[model samples]
Structures are given as structure tokens and as C-alpha cells.
Target: MTDKETYQRFIDWFRRTWWDLPESVHLHPMIETYLTPEEVDLLTNIPHSSQGIEEIARTKGMAPETLEPRLRALANRGMIYESSREGSVRYRLNDSFFAMLRAALWPGRTDEATKNSAPHINRYFLDGWMDQYAEVHLKGLRALPIDRTIEDKREIMPHEDVVHVVDDKKYFCVTTCPCRHRHNLDPDMPDCPHPTEVCLHFDELAHYIVNNGLGREITREETRDILKKAADSGLVHGVSNWKDGVDTICNCCSCCCMWFESFHKLGHSASMDASNYRIQVRPETCKACALCVKRCPVDALQLRVSPQARNKFGKAAVLDPDRCIGCGVCSHKCPSQSLRLVPKDQAELTEPPRDPREYMKHYLADRKAAAAKNQNTAD
Candidate 1:
């Protein structure tokens, strides 16, 4: 196919894929701004290898200045990356984007109906299954342990800083995974657009262990022991301890954490799902102690009791499962040990419900209603 035809096809595919994402998550303006027809053609038709801007511009019959901004913009948005060699820059699409494109264009791919049905299946059956699946399938993956012996901990290291040790055998660190950092492209800055790619130093295994908390079968003490070893090995910074069924490890630095960054940008409501479970507090066993209230990361716990009836321990803690992420942070702090993470089948992970079509309907209706209300007010 011609370069222009190839580019058009890719853009159509991207738009269709983008529509699948909720309206709440929109692409950066820079991405939209630089996705010109010519640029699109270049990106789609360009071979699966890096090409210098001058060569690309010359071949495409575009000026360097005209092409440079578009190239930089694409690079910044994590859609592409630039490599410097001999004072010239070569641009290539990020691996994640390329992979997605390939999958979208692959012959005999599943129909759109199957793709649309996936979320429903995931929400109902695959929610809890993913954790187990990831564990079983990925447990053998290698990762470098942060070198605790290194005195200078201040330097920002890539994911490769650690060396993987399995069965007392050391292995060379490798970057073989695609993370969110590789796919997110911010449009605001053209020259240094994409977020820093530190995939090489990211400790995915550490994150998985922390999130999964050793296992559901293990005791808190056993989990704590594992965390302590991880900390000692320099894999985790700060307090590396286990509480309840959750492992609480101090993850320092802002850029390294997806959860922290999501929490910062979108608030706790946006960051976590109300676990497919709810925490229950036994009032009789609960000494009106408010320990659980303080430990809740999302402020899902609150103290409630009449002032006259309040004992020396003050008000009892109550859990609002709607805001809980099932991290189980609250269970550790209860002095009376009244709080327990109990499974609640009724609770869902997503808000306004999980049906994408219904969600879109409601979202669109809400927007229309709000606009009408605004117009009425103006009148």
C-alpha cells in the first residue's frame, strides 16, 4: 500500500481502539495536535526500524522544521522514542505501541464483538484469576535485587540496578517487559516528551509480591519474614514489614510508583477499586479503639459512636467498603483485632457499574443534562 494509505489505515485503527477507553481518560492534547495526515502516513508506512529525521523528511518531501516538531511530539507522548547517534536523532515507535498496532492489524484476529465482551468476562470471572494466573505464569521470571551494600542510595537508578538471584545463582539483569511508562505519551513537551523510560531498573517482582502479599494461605508472620528478607536484600527501601495479609513496603521516589502517581493525579477514588470484598468490624469485639481509622490509606475507615456512650477507647471504627481497595492495611492497626477483611460478593470494583455501554450512556446523559442545566440558568 502507498505510504498515505498505510497511515490512514493506522489512524482509523487507533481511533477505534481509543474509543474503547472511557471518556474520563482522554489522550493528551499534544498527541492530537501532532497527529497530522502526513505524520500519520510516515509513522504507519515507515519500516519497523529507526530512521533519522532528515532522511524521513527528504523521502517524504517535508521540511525539517515542519517534520521535527511532529517527530518530537510523537516521541514525547511515549508513542515513539528517539535515539542519538553521531549528533543525529533516529526515531522509532515504542515497543508497546508497536505491539498493540501489530495485534490490531494481525490477520484473523478476534472480531470486535469478542473484544467488547472481554471486560464483562474479566469483571465477573477473571478479576481474582489474574492474580493467580500472573503468579503461576510469571513466578519464574528473573529480577535484580536492589544492592543494599551500595552506600549512595540517592542516585536514581533504572530497573536494571538490581541483579537477579535465583536458587543462589546470579543472573544478568534484562529488560523484557513493557510497562505503562512505555505507552504513555504526554503531548505538552516536544523535545523531551515521553516520561523517562526506567523499565530497566523497575522491580516488577517486588511490586507483585507487595501487592499479592506473599499469598492468601501464608500467615502474617511468614509474610513479614519474606518482606524483611526483601528489605535486607536492598529490594525495598524504608519500612519493609508485613501487616495482616498485606505487605507494607516503603516505595521511595515519586516517578517509580504507578499507584502513587495515579493516586496523586486522580485521587484515591480514581486510583483503586472498592475491593470485591468488604471489611467488617465486630462491634462486640471492637474496643471503641480508632486504630484502624488512622491506618486506612484511602480514609475509608471512620470512627462512629455517641459521645455519651464513648468509652476510654473513644468511637469504634467503621469501614466503608465503597472506598476500600482491599489492601488490608486496616486489619494490622486494630488493637482489639476487631477489623477483618471479609468477602462481600455484592461489592464491585468499578463505580457507576462495570458495563461499558451503560457507563457511556450514563456519562453522555449526565453531560447532556449538565449542559441543559447550564443553558437554562443562563436563560
Candidate 2:
């Protein structure tokens, strides 16, 4: 096949994974930017299931020694996952979703390849790639409310509490924020002013990242410190949208976060699922500082004149419930303690799925249903 056809073949293989690239989207720029024709050829033939080099090399009709370097190169580039067990090593092709995006940029490569690919990746995301999640209720991540920012701590669940989520983890690691890193690398995109190395991971995921040279290991104390710094800088703590075994916490900013960009720029319903909590305004003590209004990532809080206003401006923050993600970024910086996270009304709350598998199931089903509905309307 021609080089273009070879890359197309590789792109088609991504369909076998959980994320199916929309038919209307052309990813050739992204695919060609980071991957060489030879690398694409090798990836096209590799098995998705994990296997030892001896087994996989035999399939490619090359000696294990000959194929080992190629596989290692791919693993280093985040095209494949490398794992070791019982002193034995194995490899597997990465999926199109997290592995494709996270693995591609998490290491924070500033090389030309990464830089050139940034615009292509960013463009594709805006050009219908994220539309797939427009109707999916179970998003890939959810906001984790800042510690001590909740109105009533007694009502907070383990999953919703940022402190509890961090305490539950045994291992900790930090990596570059892929979302910000990608945009920062792109000359055409505006730089994200927030720090890049604020992404956190735990347990087996942390080990994998450290072992792969994708991130650095840190202590639990450092993890908390980083979270604190992120909160102080107006970053939202976003975790996987599941109740258990949460692998990651992204310090997200509205300017460069994949989810936020999708919501704010692309006009999606939400960047991710709002936490079970929502921000409650104490207008009486608001001071009319408008700090919360300025810090809110989602424009959820706006200043308005009200009878409850007591400050000089005669304006207090009012919440647009539909826009709040309950991230508590606004409340964390509130000078007068006028903003706090409160449990959403029972009728408005939606629990996250039990785990990643369940999240994927619900997400795919909803996306499929949305696609069908759109198709019907078009017809």
C-alpha cells in the first residue's frame, strides 16, 4: 500500500478499540505527524492483546532480538504499553482513547514531532471528535470538590471528596498536564499559563508511568501540596468518573483542558459530569468582591444586584446551576467564605458509574443512542 494508505490502515485499527473515530473526521495529519510509515506498518501488524516478545516476534517473522528494539521504540512513543510480571516483560498496543491522547503528550515531549502534531490533534478534537460525547451522560471525568470547601462535610462521600480520593491511594506520581502541554506546544494555540506538571496518578498506574519515564514518583505529602497549589492557582481537580479504583486526577484549566475546551469552545452540554455537590452562594456575606465570579472556570457564577447584597457594589454572586461543575475552584478562593459546595438536590443529582468498565458501557450506549437519534432527525 502507499504511505497514505498505510497510515489509513493504521487509523482503521483504532476502531477496534473503545473509541471509534468519527467517519467525518480526517486524522491523517495527526497520524502522520508523530508516526513514521515504518512505525505505522509495525503497529498495524502488532496484536492488541499483551504478549511476550518471542511470541509477537514470531508472528512478524522476525527474531525476538530484531523486533525488540522496534517494540521498545513504539512503547517509548506511547504507541504501545509495556508491562512486566514475574521478571517477564510483555507489550500491547494502546487503545485509541486515553492511551492515544494521554500517552501521546503526558511525557511532555517538546520536540518538533510533538509540536507539529499539536495543531492536528487540537483541530481534530474540535472538528467532530468531541461531539461524540455531546449526549453521553457518563463523561470520562468528574470534578472532585476541594477539601473543606463543602458546606457540610458530613454529607461528602469518599469519591466526591478530594482528600479522601488522595488518601485512598498508595502510590503517587506526577506528570505534565497533557491538555495544557499539547496546546502550549502548538504555535497556533494560546499558551496555558497554568503549570504543566500537575497531573497526578496512583497505584499500578503510577508505577507504570514512572517505570515508563512518563512521570516522576512523589510522596503522599507532595501530592497534597500539589493539589493545594493547583487549587490556589484556580485549577479544578478532575478525576475519572467512577466510584472506585480512580487512576488519575487532572488539574484542569478552562483554557487548555480537553474536557473544558469541548464544553466552552465546542458548546457541549458539560465538560464532565458535575460533582454530586453544587456551589451554594451566601449572598449575605458575599462582600460583593466578585472573586468567585472571576475564579469560576465555567462562568457558573455571575455578579448581580440583589436585595441580599450588603456590600458597597450592591451586587452578589448568583449561580447558574446549569453551568456549575461543582469543582469548588471558586469557593476555594472566596475571600469572605461566601461560597461553598453543597449536596445537589436529590432530583438533580446523578451518581457516577461504579467503575471504568461501567462508565464505558453507559458512555458507549448513550453515544450510540445519540447517533441514532441524530441520524433519524437528519433522515
Candidate 3:
């Protein structure tokens, strides 16, 4: 009824979607800062599923031309998704994770509202909101090993190989890393030194992003170049936790990545599931440069005394297998080539769900079970 109630209702609507806000972040400042009473009111009329302008206009009880501009404005603001296929245009509300966070900032918008929301979004993630994602045993993302870091090429699956993942797509694009972009926007936050424009999208997702001006279309070779630059910067390759139809590959740094920061700063139990591979160390050949130790995002590697080590310090990188995510950032930069990712013991390996269909089935089941558990505890 009131403006406050209208905004709260919009927040409530997002809760029913794939990503629910944690209880502590019910009215997140970042959400409040960008959204307005008028925007919230208009968004309520938009459907979750895509529909044509005429169809939406009928629902609004207005002329199609009258309603089109409003819908286009929301789409431009990243509050809605728009697509054009075969001369027809359609629109739908973007999911909260994208609308409020990823897509909202990925375009590197310099507008006042976007800049103001940055610090609040960064604070929300760091404070407690990220724990909701970690509560589910099924992670949304999995580490993809860097190229040339696998110990045995024969063991690499198409999904596990970054090059194959890129090759599988017909379209490619690059966008600013929302995580790093957020931190870089906030003057109070520590400056993130890693490359920011390395978030890669492919296929239909790439089409949507580029069409919406969220990112720029790039050649596959350019995409690979971005991947190479990310690896050189000690960034981990993170992709959707699925075996097929993976749409995104985020070049994540421990300092600003949502998943990595959730694990490293918020003390979440886990950020992402490890790849099927784990680092294999050759202590005898280890130069003990400690690059791997420094590069490991998960604190998985440490330099310790090793009689077998050939380096001056008599210390070599030792892995806490439990902590390694098999991301290969460490191995990619190994000067002595003493570290490489090898297939985990078959019994310990985890293959991601076959595709988005299977992945969401498992994800929804986990969410439902977690909700039930929390309700029972409350009772």
C-alpha cells in the first residue's frame, strides 16, 4: 500500500527466486540504494517469464508504445532482461542475483547511484549474506584448472578443460568482474590490483550480455587471451558447477571474488567444490620459490621443511589436500614445474551434475531441505 511496503514487497518477490537473501540481509542497503518506489511499483507488473511488448501492454492496460519505454528503461537499469529474436522483442524480470549484483555493476557504469551502491554491496557480502550460498552442499561454481596444469592430458574431461569449454561456444564476450569492480568503486575498500575485465560469457548468455550492453562481444581468440592474462595474474578459473552448457567463466581473485571472499573472509565452510583433480607436488624438484604457496586462493599450500627438496631453503610447498580446490592457479605459475593438477583418487572425485537441468534439481532439493531444517529448529 505504502512506498515502504512496495519496496519490501519487491524484496520479498526476489526471495522466492533461485537466490533468496539471507535473513540478516533482508533489506540490504545495496538493494535500497539503486531501487526506487517508482521502479519497484513498475517491476511488480513484469512477469518472471519472457513476454512480448503487446502481451505485457495488455497486462498493463495501456498502449504498447506507452508501456515499451518503461520496460526498456528497467531493462537498461539491469532490473529486467530483454531479448530480441526474429524481429520480436520480449522482456522479463532478471533474477535478484543478477539484477541487484552481477549485471548491475558488470557494465562498469559510472552513474552516481551505481557508485553509491558499491560499498553497501561489498559490505553486505562480507558481513553475512554469502553464508546462504555456502549452506547448500551443492556449490553453484566449481574451479576449472588452468591450461597446461593438468599432470596428464588423457585424464582431462571436456568440461574440466578450459580450452574445450571455450571451444564449445559459438559466441564470446568479456565483462568487468563485478566483484573487483565493486571494490574498485568504493574508495574505502582496498584497491584490487587484479585485471577487472576478465569475466567471460559464452553462447546465449554472451548474446544477452552484449545485446544488453553489459559486456562487449569478442572473438574466441580474445577470450582465450583474457583467460591467459587471468592465469598469469594468479586468478582462478571458476565456472558453473555443471558438466555441460556452462555459460560463464569468472577469473576470480581471493581478494574480491564472492566465492573466495566468502570462504577466506566470512569463514564459510566451503566456497566452491574442488575439481576432480588435486595438486601433485614433486618435492625433489621443488625450487621452493613459494609462488604456489602465495598463489593458492584457499590457503591450501604452505612451505615446510622437506629433506627431499633441492632448493636452498630445504623447504617445499606441501598441500593440505582437504583445502585444495584444484583450481591450478598455483601450478600455472610454477617456475620449476614442480606442481601440477592430477586426477583425484576415483573414490574422492566429484563430477558436476550433467547440465543445468540436473544441477538445479539438486540445488532446489538442497534448498528445500535446508529450509525445512531451519523451520524445524525454529519450532
Write model 1 residue lDDT over 181-256, tens digit each, in one string: 2122212212222222111111332332222221123333433444344333222222111111111223222232
Per-model lDDT: 0.38, 0.86, 0.86
lDDT of the structure predicted as candidate 3: 0.86
Rank candidates, TM-score, best first.
2, 3, 1
Candidate 2 segments exceeding 4 Å error? 23-26
Please give the TM-score that candidate 1 achieves against the real structure.
0.33
Mind giving the per-residue lDDT tens digits that candidate 2 earns over 164-258? Answer: 89999999999999899889987788888888899999997788788777888999999999999999999999998898899999999989988
With a 3 Å backbone cut-off (N, CA, C), the pairs that clash in candidate 2 are: none
Error of 1 at 263 (Å): 6.8
In angstroms, the error of model 1 at 101 is 18
- Candidates sorted by lDDT, best first: 2, 3, 1
**What local lDDT does model 2 show for residue 143?**
90
Flag the better candidate by lDDT, 1 or 3: 3
Error of 3 at 368 (Å): 1.7
Counting only residues 3 or more apart in sequence or on different chains, how many pairs clash (N, Cα, C under 3 Å) in candidate 1?
A: 13
Which candidate number maximizes TM-score?
2
